[model samples]
Target: MSGSILNLFSLQGKTAIITGGTGGIGLAITTALAEAGANIISIEVPHDPASPLLRQAIEATGRKITVYDCNLKDHESIRATFHAIWASGSVPDILVNCAGITRHMKVEDTPVQDLDDVMAINFRGTYLCIQEFGRELLRLQRPGKIINFASIAAFLAQTNISAYCSSKAAVQNLTRAVSNEWAGKGITCNAICPGFIHTKMCEDLYTDKEFSARVVARTSMGRWGEPEDIRGLAVFLASAASDFITGESVFVDGGIMGR
Candidate 1:
């Protein structure tokens, strides 16, 4: 790539706030952004053991990383966490709402509480974080980027995960709604729809030999995606290179969507 193209992807002096940045795909995103030269503010659950490991990983890239404890399911907690982040003088230029949960129960068998739990974290939590992050950006009149983690489930109805599918569908639209409102204000919002990646969230499913076979056969690439596979798009969406793109859901599905 030319110097001009590389420069567009540089995140030097920028700071990013990522929810669920301590493990799995979230850790991949944290590494990608940090390697791109952005300082990191990782919002993880209280006392998550992975926080220290995440700190060590980012520091290895020669970038600063701060970990904050927050319960994403609570709106007040999200607000207070953002406030604390600001008070610490790391006003972020990017926000990645990568925190989510899923329940693998059929619709008829799923409890109302389970449904509520999925929606609370996947959809409501993302919305609350965006609201808080956007408020700060608007107040400062600064340009910003917002990346939400939607899923291939948002586009397809998978069996036994009705609540997870529904929540991600809401996230897909929410990304567009935010972009419509924020794009002209110098803030671009987009969603990333991942396919069957080999993350802990789907470890059981992937470990099932027959199920894993089906996934590999279905994906044109003939393999499960790794956390590292998410890096390039994550970097692009967080950087100036994607400034013209907003309200779009880009899939890094290794051709599963194509199939």
Candidate 2:
């Protein structure tokens, strides 16, 4: 293959904004994008200790990273962060909506507040970021990429996470809606559904031997996913490598969904 063909995956000179880029799968995705030559802007909540670590790691790669402390659930906060990002002279060519929350409660036991919280952080927050930044990309006539973080729960119903599953499903649909609306404007939107990744968020489940065994047994890979497992897909989605793909939900679940 020619060098130009191979270089389609290169993200040189691109800038990326990653929501929830401080830890877990978010951190891994941020680093991978940075290593692939994209300037990183990590959006995190205030006082998150992991933010500094993530920044340092990305900076060590000789790529620039800017950390903004903004509450994803708060509209004003998100607006302010965007203004700051623009003022700082970083215009994003890619956006990864990785910030999200889940509440573990059965449908009968789920409080209205819990459901509202999940919707705010997972669905509404993602929507707001895309709307605001996407407009800028469109106005500038820049071809941009957006990757939303969905979950395998969006496809498979799980116990004690009714609100989470519903919110993720909304995200998947929202990706399609956004892509359909903006495809003519040179923007691509898609969702990533991850299953049982070994992140801090799922440490408790992994710690339980019986539960872990059951999860492993259900997966065709017979193992849980590592944070790094998601890096390549994230990079591919953000680069020109996936330019022809949009409005699709790609699963990175170790084949668990097939079972």
**Superposing all C-alpha atoms, what RMSD in Å does each candidate have to the true structure?**
1.0, 1.1
lDDT of 1 by residue, 157-246 (tens): 899999999999999999999999999999999999999999888999999999999999999999999989998999999999999999
Error in Å for residue 5 of model 2: 3.2
Supply candidate 1's per-residue lDDT for 75: 84
Model 1 worst lDDT window (10 residues): 85-94
lDDT of 1 at 1: 55
lDDT (Cα, tens digit) per residue for candidate 2, span 87-192: 8877769999999888876799988888899999999999999988987887678889999999999999899999999999999999999999988887999999
For each candidate in turn, the TM-score is: 0.98, 0.97
Cα error, candidate 1, residue 256 (Å): 1.4
Candidate number of the best lDDT = 1
